[model samples]
Target: MTSYYTIDHLPGRTIQLDGQDYLFFSGTSYLGMAQHPAFQALLAEGMARYGTMFGSSRNGNLQLNIYGEAEAQLAAFARAEAALTLSSGMLAGQAVVNWLKAQGFGFIYGPKAHPAIWQDPSTSLPTVSFTDWTDQLPELVAAAATPNVVIALNSLDALCSVDYSFDWVNRLPDGQEVTLLVDDSHGFGVIGPEGSGVGALIPRRANVRLIVTASLAKAMGMPGGVIFADPETLRAIRHTAFFGACSPIPPAYLHAFGRAQALYRTAFERLQTNIARFENRIGLSDRFQHIPAYPVFYTEQDQLYSYLLANRILIYSFAYPTPADKPNTRIVISALHQPEDIEQLGDCLYGKTG
Candidate 1:
């Protein structure tokens, strides 16, 4: 039988459920900035400077400049020509899809692409057959007659246990230009130098146009979504009805985001250290390419969920944003997790007696 519990109280890495504290390993706040006093101070200061909400639409004549400032800062961090911020990462993905559809671009979706990219059933655009591997992408692109073809995928697919490599960018047949739309939601603020996302790992190429979108709510411990693209692309998107009609992210949050750069960098280092220790204790194989920021273990034989819960550890177990047939046990290690917590969880997973 399945049982349910609620978090009555939360204190950083630990949660109170059933009047007992349990170490949490299921949340996406990878850098642990959500509970940082310093980060909270910045948010409070922002709230003081800017009101709690900027309820006005972006299309309004009078608007706050904090939104533009935040977008510029994010663009510089992502090393892109320009950036746009939306209320949520899902909206950011939808904005991109809407732009592509408006531009008459056909899509070649990756097998493990996030549902947000193709969740809209009302879309009338054409889609090529889903390609499960990089080797099959070029032929599909070559066959498409559309002026622009988009290859949509996730930078790190934890569900399939695959980390995309840039080598595939070189394999695309010459003269067949394809745009890459990557949803790096899981990798942002977790991987790459200074948590710049997967774009930092892949060398920039002149042959392909790269566009990436991610949710700041994840590792960044902030709300909203950001899009990185060229100036022309961003400008075109900005002029769309979606951008003009939607409300901008709260001014105070954007102000806080602009000021939390240094904190994010510091937290990233600590998170990496915790990941390394956990991986060492668990003895992970080299073949597993999922990002260290997201420590997901795949097992069909072991009852690890019940085992961990019995030990007062909470983890996320579900098949979501992935094929329903394939489920994964996700253990998210954050910077807030203590060394002993990591060791204890590692010991539990490996059945090691300490």
Candidate 2:
């Protein structure tokens, strides 16, 4: 069985548990926006103006203007023709999948694609490696009898600490019209130019339609999910019952997200510096598998999990998505960590004490 623990407060550079303090090195907070004082203050100001929550549907007569304003900013930032916001990233994924299902398109999923983008909840994900899957994608799509197909995948696989390329989209046979759906939940505020995510970098073509979905909660520190697509497709999706019936993301979050752009840039730079510093300290070793400029460092060294715990250092080590999956052990670097914290973590990884 996997172990579990609880903490009373939000984790930053460190976490406190059972009267003990440990250097925290887990979670998807790449930009460290959650614990940022300026960001928090912006959120507080937002709450003061918008209140805690808005329970009505977005389609209701009384609408908060912040929703449209923030979404416009998001669309501009992502370079998408249009954008839509939902209560959660899962809901955003489901809404897009549900819409695609109604259009009668066949689905092809990437190996590490999140369950959020799955067409059917009970369907199992492929057990093959990502490279293997990519190699077979063109042949697989060419063989499918369906006229329309949707290829769903993640912008990058965070659990495995691997970044993916969309060059395969160009290799697929032209017989079927393709809609590329990317779940950028992990990459939204950490990857790509200006931390805009992979939406802008994905190659565009005449016949291929692109849709990018992300949870802003990860690095953006907003309690919401966003969808980016062409204007016509976005209009159709907006009309869906899934979009109409669901509660929208808290207006306060949108309020803060719109005003904290500069703060986000600073955090991204800090996170990059921290990742570089940590990598330099650790150097190249078989003990870790990671990508340059990425924040996660994955490892199969299960013993290190316990060893770090004994030394008051914490990282992710557990069965992810389900109990049947491999224990998702990784060290997550974040912008909140300082030079001293990085040094301490490096010492712990080397089996040395303060």
Output the number of the lDDT-best candidate.
2
Model 2, 127-176: lDDT tens digits are 89888998999888887668898989999989878989888777877666
lDDT of 1 by residue, 215-240 (tens): 88888777788888998988888889
Looking at candidate 2, the ten consecutive residues that score lowest on lDDT are 345-354
How high is the CA lDDT of each candidate model?
A: 0.76, 0.89
Candidate topping TM-score: 2
> Candidate 2: lDDT of 333?
96
Runs in model 1 deviating more than 4 A are 122-132, 284-294, 319-327, 351-354
Return the clash pairs for model 1, or none.
none
All candidates: CA RMSD in angstroms? 3.2, 1.7
Q: Evaluate residue 209 in candidate 2 and report its C-alpha lDDT on the 0 to 100 scale.
A: 93
